[model samples]
Target: MPTITTTDGTEIFYKDWGTGQPVVFSHGWPLNGDAWDNQLKLVADNGLRGIAHDRRGHGRSTQTYVGNHMDTYADDLAALIEKLDLRDIILVGHSTGGGEVARYLGRHGSERVAKAVLLGAVPPIMLQSDTNPEGTPLEAFDGIRNGVLADRSQFYKDLSVAFYGANREGSNISDGTREAFWLWSMQVGVAAAYDCVKQFSESDFHDDLAKIDVPVLVVHGDDDQIVPIAAAALKTAEIVKDATLKVYEGAPHGIVGSSYEQRFNADLLAFAKS
Candidate 1:
């Protein structure tokens, strides 16, 4: 098992494949690096190296009693990149991982990065605030927290329906699909899983987005129920200086391994090479 030890001694498990310009990936909350398997396979087959790390306290990483927030998350990413001496990198992030990418660039600088992609990402902030009144209500996030504390197993299983739009009309999502989501989510440590709800919901990324110097590809499903396009992808595209936004009509938050898989993979490959 490949891993990188953070400054604080967290052993972050990672998958590294292929050999070319590197594309480092970050996964969403409550999921390990394995959530990006499809993307990893696609990228590696196309001659680009794909690297994804399980965040601390999630999956094979250390389950620590401290640092379960964005700052530490970004710093851990930086430590990984530095320790591995990776450069001219393309960073891809999904959901909370998008915030991690933004925070990583803002906090540590993107001197090593070449380009970036944010897919179904949460950014600019998810919780409603005075400045961002269009954001999701605090009650919704509170409900997420309640669900995590009340019944995490059931919560992830239930969340899979909306996450993949399985409940949508004419949807063909399978039972195995939902079960895969549950399995990925269950790998997270309870403390990290619980604390990440707040991290993903409330971490403001306006300044961080503004700080991004590399070209970005922002992809989102128009019907994304978890991280709504109106609040996340659209706003992130607007904030990032050079971003090309792609909206998949009628698509759900989880696009990889779905009908949108080929389209997304092509776009990602094109972006990485561009």
Candidate 2:
């Protein structure tokens, strides 16, 4: 029910709970602050203020027709932090949210931030090029765009399976988890979701990663199907000076709130306390 109006007048919905040093969360693409519910409750229960905001055009935030790129996403986050006058905050981001954190620190600086965490995040770069040939192909992103344009609901449902590793063999993912992912995905505006596909896939965070000077915890699932660990956390950890890398052997992309939630919560709490 709480909201912050960005400079552009976009109403960004947020959830702030408990009291202590703040641990701010940024959700992934096509998802909202609710995606961090488990982590937020965990941090709040442990005597920390947990805050998460729905990016513009996602969830309860104003579904604007423009400003769906990473710069705007990062600016929106900065606006939230400044409006709340939050300091000594630990910023944590997952999937696309990770990119947001990186850009925020890069564009806005780390004057008020204490630490940062990136879980199954897309950063450094995710698209293949002459210099970064291991990145995902542009055509793959095109396929996602086409799918969303065709039947957004079905596309989200199908993506949820892979997003949480439900489609993988021997995966113990539950039906509810997949259902939640689909519901969150559907809450995103059609145009915003489509534009984010390009933003997350094409945006390069090389400079952003380099700009981060605070302690960073880079956690990734080796078996991640959505944003492959090789192109994301691995490179990210290497780029950020003195970053701690924690790899979950068989965990999938949605490790933040799925079966791996316990492990993530523990790591996040430990880092926030450290």
Tell me the lDDT of candidate 1.
Answer: 0.91
Local distance difference test, per candidate? 0.91, 0.92
Q: Positional deviation of 41 in candidate 2, in angstroms?
A: 0.6
Q: Backbone collision count in every prediction?
A: 0, 0
Candidate 2 lDDT over residue span 1-274, tens digit each: 7899988899999999999999999999889999998888999999999999999999999998999999999999999999999999999999999999999999999999999999999999999888888789999999999999999889989988888888778878778888888989888998999999999999999999999999999999988999999888889999999699999988988864445788888888898888
Candidate 1, pairs of clashing residues: none
lDDT of predicted model 2? 0.92
Highest lDDT scorer: 2
TM-score of each: 0.98, 0.98
In model 1, where do residues sit more than 4 Å from their true spots? none
